[model samples]
Target: MANHLDLEEQEQLDQFKHFWKQYGNAITWVLIAVLGSFAAWNGYQWWSKRQAEQASAMYEEVERLIGTGDLVASTRAFDDMKQRFPSVFYTQQSGLNLAKAAYLSGKPDVAKTALTWVAGSKADTGLAALAKVRHAGLLIESKEFDEAGKLLSTDFPSEFGGLVADKRGDLALSQGKSDDAAQRFNEALKLLPQQDQYRRLVEVKLAALGSTEAK
Candidate 1:
């Protein structure tokens, strides 16, 4: 009976050895892949967080320059932030702020360049749409009527429909198309929320165009 028990234990040990020989390499590779992916994921998360923190610091510097009314310094800081962290949210925001500052500083060319960059970038869609609208306004100021029209014609967020219509009205009015301007302004009025101050401005435009029903 003792010999039989020894043989039974040996048989069990041999079966375990056979199983390891058959599947040990595949199991080892599977574990290695899972562990590698987890390590990679952790590394990516850490890297992304570090990048965001650094970009945030740069954005604060840009904001400080803007607050000091130093357009040149603000632009330089923004450029640095974009170069280093182009995919960051703060970088896109810096572009918008820089464009505004450039425009107000009588640097329409700089403003347009920044705005165009934001508009064409893979930033947030709403921010991109806003940049396009602002760029269109600058184009209108420069009498680039066709280009402004094209920018306004691009698809925007639903919330921007009214603003886009108003821009179209401005373009039409600039081109001496009063009827079209009035129609577009009326469309803007319909699309705008009741409490929107911009709606009042559109109403004024419609009134100027001999449309008494803009209220």
Candidate 2:
């Protein structure tokens, strides 16, 4: 009876060994792939958190520099921060601030550069669309009529239709197309919600343009 038990145990061990020999490498690799992916995911989350913290600190520094009203120093600091973390939320916001600062400082070229960078970013599509709209306005101010027209004609998301139409009207006005401008502004009025203060602003523009309906 003992000999019979030994034979049975040996047979089971042999069967297991055969099975392992046939699939050991594939099983090992599958486990490694699964575990490796989990580890990589955790590492990426940690890295992203660290980067965001660093970027937030850098953005605060840039804000301090801007607040000092030292345009040259602020611009340099902003440049450095953007180079390091172009896709970070803080970096994107800093770009918008820099654009406003530069434009207000009569540095349209620098402002355009900042706005262009923000507009091109894919990290935040909503911010990017806002940047594009602002950039189009600046281009119009610069009398880059063709470029402004092209930018204003963008197929913006539905939520931004009113803003886009308003911009298009501005572009038309810049090009001396008053009738077209009125049409676009009226379109904006229809697209914009009644409660949106921006819609009131558009109404003002339409009134100024003598759109009878806007009256």
**Which parts of model 2 have CA positions greater than 4 angstroms off?**
213-215
Q: What is the overall TM-score of model 2 with all chains considered together?
A: 0.94
Tens-digit per-residue lDDT, 1-215, candidate 1 = 99999999999999989998999899999999999999999999999999999999998999999999998888888888878988887888889999998888899999999898888777578888989989998999899998998888888989999999999989989899999999999999989999888888898898888886455
TM-score of each: 0.87, 0.94
List, residue by residue over 1-215, the lDDT tens digit for candidate 2: 99999999999999999999999889999999999999999999999999999999998998888788777887898889878888888888888888888888889998889888898877788888889999999999999989998887776778889899999999998889999999999888888888889987788887888786542
Global lDDT of each candidate: 0.89, 0.87
Which 10 residues in a row give candidate 2 its minimum summed lDDT? 206-215
Cα lDDT for residue 20, candidate 2: 94
Model 1's lDDT to the true fold?
0.89
